[model samples]
Target: MARSTILIADNSCMIRKGLRSILQNLENSEVIQLIDNKEDVCGIVHKRKPDILIINPDMLPGDCLDVKRELFNENKLSLILLSNRKNLKNDLKADGYINYMDGQNTILDMMQEILNKNNKSSFPNKNSETISSREKNILKHIALGLTNKEIADQLFISIHTVVTHRKNITQKLGIKSVSGLTVYAILHNLISMDEVK
Candidate 1:
């Protein structure tokens, strides 16, 4: 069982302390950092590369999309929106959300789900054989969110060859989704998160 590293970013001291206290009780979870301002969130996140980041959407700097893109490009982590409203903003791309009014059980359950998903995506198939270097190039492109045609053109290979390599990569890793492959690539150091689009 892998431990999940968590970072809480909120302007409110009480909110940060409360979340940290509640999160500490979760099994195999650690509250690694408590951030009080938005400015430090991205910098710390890039440095620590926590497994989960629970933050208020308002804490994000300037344009949310740009900040999110930069943060995710550097670190593979789950983002959880922390808000007081029951109806969360639909625009934010987050794994989960925790309301200020939510009970301890609700928070625990949400965090657990994020942790489970992270663990599943982050770990690779142990019994699988080694991937060929050519297949690895394709996997890196796939993890970087490149289309088959793009990968084929970039590698000077046919689209059919790219597809075949993708199939082989999936078979070897037992990971079907692009997101899963991205996580695997990051974990294996096949591609850095900074390279992800």
Candidate 2:
């Protein structure tokens, strides 16, 4: 089997380097791209077309959610958006927010999980008024502080879709701000205090 290509996007060179090393060590993984410039992530994804894209939520510029969708447009690349552990249960990040008790280990684990899924392109159905699986996946990233672009890359959805999820989530829950959604997620058991705090 061909080694899986990995893309790293972050504003910090040191962080990107560290992630690059980790991915390099994986048996089927290779760091095919590294992006420290926010302006370049979208363009890079379009050009390189890696199998998996790992991004830091805070690193991307402009409505982070928008970036998520942009990357998902032409490919089925899996995403690994680093996020705080508290985010899994709550909030409405544009997308690409994944909670990790241990950011590094969690990322590796998530990658393994995706591989287990064999890069299946099936996402949560889009019908119904309640939060769909795709929305839930993105919300998990938001609570973790992932930006829109990060979420898009992670979920393989469009930035527009990530934004749509955020809007729909807020409308259904009657919440807007991140803090408010975080709190609602916690209070309603959508997420736990441990995850929120």
Candidate 3:
């Protein structure tokens, strides 16, 4: 198993230290960087290219959409949002979110889940095929509990096209049930847990 590298970015020293402590228990994982300022995040992420990034969007300037695009587009890494806000903005694309008040066990479990998913994706099945970006979009919508018609309407595509994409997704992933596909979407970071219905 490859070593999983994680970067923590938060303005709070206590939160950073606490998250570091909790992450220390993860097997074959390393906390590569602890960033306290938004100014240095992009540069560090570009250089280090950690496998996972645990960051607070508030630490970044503006809406952080530019940072998200730069980091995510450049690297295939998991982005976990660290926030205590009751209502998180939907614009921030994150693989997961950890509340400040969450217990250590819950945090650990979330990390472990991300690690497990990372591992699985790192080495996929030999016969397993990849899905296209369009299919992924449809799969994400499906996982979000959208009906076929809803997905078609949202994507501005015909219902027949949506159905075809869903069929292709099912065949490629070998997952027929919606629940199974939802799990796949969540694990693959296509959609966060909060987004799933």
lDDT of 1 by residue, 141-170 (tens): 999999999998998999999988888889
Prediction-by-prediction clash tally? 0, 18, 0
Q: Which ten residues in a row have the lowest lDDT in candidate 2?
A: 119-128
List candidate 2 stretches off by more than 4 Å.
64-67, 88-104, 119-197
Whole-model Cα lDDT of every candidate shown, in order:
0.85, 0.68, 0.88
List per-candidate RMSD values in Å: 14.6, 20.9, 16.6
lDDT of 3 by residue, 72-138 (tens): 6869888888999856646666788898988999999989999988888876652357999999999
**Ten residues in sequence with the least summed lDDT for candidate 3:** 63-72
lDDT preference between candidates 1 and 2, better one: 1
Clashing pairs in 1: none
- Regions of candidate 1 where Cα sits further than 4 Å from its true position: 65-67, 124-197
lDDT minimum window of 10 residues, candidate 1:
62-71
lDDT agreement of model 2 with the native = 0.68
